[model samples]
Target: MKNIYSLFGLLFISQLTFSQATLEGSIVDENNQSVLATVYLPQIEKGAVSDVNGKYLVTQIPNGNYTVIISALGYETLSFKLSFLKNETIAKHIVLKERAVEMEEVIISTPFHKLQSENVMKVERITTEQLTKNGAVNLSQGISNMAGVSTVSTGNGIGKPVIRGLSSNRVLTYTQGVRLENQQFGDEHGLGISGNGIESVEVIKGPASLLYGSDAIGGVLYLNPEGFATDNETEVDGTGSYFSNTKGFNSSIGAKTSGEKVKFLVRGSRASFSDYETGDEYRVTNTRYNEYDIKTGIRFQDKRLKSTLRYNYNRSNIGIPEEIGAQNTSKELLLPFQEIDNHILSLDNTLFLNNSSLDIKTGYLFNDRREFEESADEAALRLKLNTFTYDVKYNLPELGHFTTIVGVQGMLQDNKNFGEEILIPNAKKVDFGVFATTHLHLKDWDFQGGLRLDTRKIKTEDARNPQDEDFIPSIDKDYNSFNVALGAKYNFSETFTGRLNLASGFRAPNLAELTSNGVHEGTNRYEIGNPDLNNEQSFQTDLAFEYRSEHFEAFANGFYNTINNYIFISPTGDVIEDNRVFNYVQNGAKLFGGEIGFHLHPHPLDWLHWESSYETVIGELKEGGNLPLIPANTLNNTIRLELNDGGFLKSPYSFITLENIFAQNNASEFETTTKGYNLLSLGFGATVKWNKIEFNWGVNATNITNESFINHLSRLKADEILNPGRSINFNLGFTL
Candidate 1:
């Protein structure tokens, strides 16, 4: 009996061992000395940090294939594919190379998560930390720092992103892996998203319809959320910032904890700003704003599945400045202001199979927007929007050097009016898209291509009453389109690379474009929409070249885009109720632009860096005239110094930047020319450690010379309102 029991026990032990796998690795520098690093397998959401001896181990992994990423500070990140079998233990050794610049991270916006150097398409990425270091007061202002990206500003408190030369419904924004739908059709509407709890931002400068479908006809702005803490770790953090120009202050607190199988995190933030002062020391009345935001997330992971749920709530009270009148410093909103409340909830799940995986994501969003004009307690216009979206993708098993993914995405949306006035009729919208994409890799070449089909339907209810001046007839319409993208990346040498891509995109007419027959108070225009409107289709060609080495990096990117049936609203030489009349029309349009820049960190002076870049874009109708709201050319130069350590301060750094904006002479008929201007900025920061406590502090001054200027895309351009200037900003943060 004892011998039989022993045999059974041995069999059980063998089976248990065969069900799990182990991965072990050692990391070292070029000199073969131990170097601490992080080894992560994103697919399974598992990772480990190397010990002082440079040894790391991850166990209990199921049998499958994965891409492992190894990264460390001051070292070039490395990634490769690996396969593991049941009961198998894999041991690997890695040698990291020193780099003058920071290491590159995996790009999540792309279908295949790969390093920038390995992607077929060029994508611009900047971390929120970097944006903070640049002294950006808000997310919209921060993104404008990137090449080929600009913003249409109503004021410092409200701004919309304009990619290349397109805004409104053309550019798509995604947060937490889901589309952000907050009534984006209006020019005065802001992003409605807070900067708190966001990790990084990624921009795809050209059409990405093959991957993201409609609304991406112009480009995509992807916002990545902060990740949870490492396994069995808990952390708490707090941050506060102050801005002098607006007499503004913002503060946030967050906490995160992660165990072997579950993780949770939450963050709360608030901000208040008074009227902003211009370069002439004139306070712009009712430019003040206040915001409250909350973000939370939870995750569960096991051997075969990983799931995450996230939620975000935001409320904002933004004042509208018609002209400079009241100068008193007050954070409370005044008349002619907007109050917006937004809620977003999302769930993501991934199921890992033997050699493949499936990913599903779903999201729900609600937006309540109210405008107050006559009385503080009464809203002149109120609109409510609800949206539900879903996306499912299946990664097919890799075949040789080719990887493929097939996906389906769709959304259901409804809009309603709750106040006395209505900009758009009560409407319902449906969107569905199917796509397939694949990537082929070779020694020196990578080829990527995809095809997609999309369909959108819009239905509206009649809003024609005898007492109402604004009338809209009920209508139902369906729009369909097919798109494709093809791209190739070639390595010219170890340090040089080139890429070429051709893609097509399409966008269905929005509700405002098809049914509006009322006054748009925001633009002071009476608008008439066309019931018969065709979809806008675009084709673009992009070319880019990059060269990188230990001490220098340079890149040049150029693109040409042409659109058919492009929609635009133009003045009709008529007036109604003291407002100019405008009509929506379609025409062919073209835009061409490019960005070139370089970074130099000369040889032994690795801590000293010089960076310069220039960007320009030209837009015009195929027949005649220039397109509206095109940004002017810009040149940016920066000198930076990084120190290894300074007494009580660790990794102290400072930078000076000079930006020049060229005059916008190529303006539309109704647009006025904007004069060129220059701005100077300086910033410095350092980390301090005391006992077991560590904190970071920084100070930045923008428009140091107090230069007065107006951007071409500013709505206040016609009123000769200047942008804010000469602001000193201070920030402090710490982690526990």
Candidate 2:
């Protein structure tokens, strides 16, 4: 970590000797008339919007092969790929066809960046713009708007994502083309990465072990970072937001610059909040938190090689909430809180061959977590975790219409306890995997299949104080698995498509499950590990169908999954250290659910849109009981009004969302059922230009009724805590 900044400075200096090319183009309608449009190079994050006359100019673009996309509100998007040479100026003209619904968008998570309509497996994509419109304050909250995605949150500071009723180590999160390791095994740990600097997110809702190796039995959350700025250009942006309920504030500023062959960017942000108010106007004490984050990246590109280096550092102080207290708003936190720092550095490099490519990714992570109780000056528990990971993939030349890719991945991890309390013993873990996948493209069908083999080894060291009865004994274990996946996409008609997929996934027991022996402060329980635990394996089948046209779009998706040796915590009918004792156990489990949704736009009232969706999931242990942590069924409805070209308001929009949550009576042993509730949210946003600067602003109100309710997936539900009350938030951003 000490030398990373020096390397970035050296790379920035080396790119001063090169020159780049430029491109200019005009986008028009089918009649060859001028039409305003947005032109972008998705890979480079460069481009400009067309003026009223449909003219656009992009400079400082590296001389290489590229793809540019042009999109307009009432026209079909256009994508073009071309090659250029240094010191060259290219002129092009493009025309777009009018359409009501958008064309299929390209997905970057797959080996081949294919459009969603052409991919064998289905993937859900969300844009940063959409997340902002949804009034989400954090990464976890933003993703919860999607179907089959929920969160187990502790107040407003910490949240863990749950996908189709599975969380923790069962899900995988990837950023900067590498896996994230931030000691996520703990229930109180939140996603370390911030929502800043991310352009989009993609979710794969089923087993993806074949593509990502292990820890993907539930799903994968893939975040795409911001691309480099355009050549010879510099951009700066700032944002500020205020929350009324918590008296919270968030502020951030970012800047980026690009040269001929090099680009760099940096961003810093700070957020702080007081206790949140409940529906009854009672303040939840010690739920306040503050965070500081910094992120930077450098990119270098040549004719055949492109590389990027990114680093992020985050520090947070979160106060654990136990009960309500005085209603005064204060940012100062009390005792019984947590202090955490996470550091991530990653290097991604790609080498292009004649018809194939070689891609390599390397990453290092460092996490330090400390818990303080009774007094802020002393910590009760401290843990440090470090991980190193590497992945290498080679794309074989295309044979006829088939594309194949082979890859190998490995990771080394070490965990240590540095404080008095030890929930898990010091351990070392190693993982290695090799996989191969192929994609077949036909006139009307897409076929994909892959197979992978993985091996993991874990070794634990005895506790620091041998005489303590809570100390766990030393142990060593090895686990192995073979996984396979097959999927197909068939275009039944011009506006109809069908997809089916089957996959197998597996997860090795984590340190907390295999070696825990003491009380865990996060969960407020005495946990006992099971050294004899085996690997958890799953098989899932998914089916989906979609119909799209100019006036409307609809989709239905269903899945059923079965797992063997599913690990879960069960009460042992005993108490230790004033806490209930919970033992790690295994049982067979099955889960089934489906999601359906539709979007409609009346012919004449094109500016008005209506959308609705419903999602449900049921998980049950094979031994005649319900599974814990399953999310309750939910339905959502939205009405939106869009003004594409408001003279002064520019892209003005307003929306109202009504969410209904159904009661959850199917709960596991020791879990209580939760009542249903309804919530209404409203928001309005617009962009305006003044004094040569662009300003974007929005106002949002959530839970307008201030109804008192508990979410089944919330960790605080066990304590019968009500969710946050009505909140009015105001946000503003500026760019120049």
Report the number of the highest-lDDT candidate.
1
Residues 307-383, model 1: lDDT tens digits: 99999999999998897898888898888999999999999988666566778899999999999999999898899
- What is the alpha-carbon lDDT of model 2 when measured against the actual structure? 0.85
Model 1, C-alpha of 322: deviation from truth (Å):
0.7
Residue-wise C-alpha lDDT for candidate 2, range 194-276, written one tens digit per residue: 78778888988989999887789999999988766776889899888888889998888999999867899999989898988
- CA lDDT of every candidate: 0.90, 0.85
* C-alpha TM-score for every candidate: 0.96, 0.92
Q: What is the RMSD, in Å, between candidate 1 and the native fold over all Cα?
A: 5.9
TM-score of 2: 0.92
Shift in Å, residue 4, candidate 1:
51
- Which one wins on TM-score? 1
Where is model 2 poorest over a 10-residue stretch in terms of lDDT?
Answer: 8-17
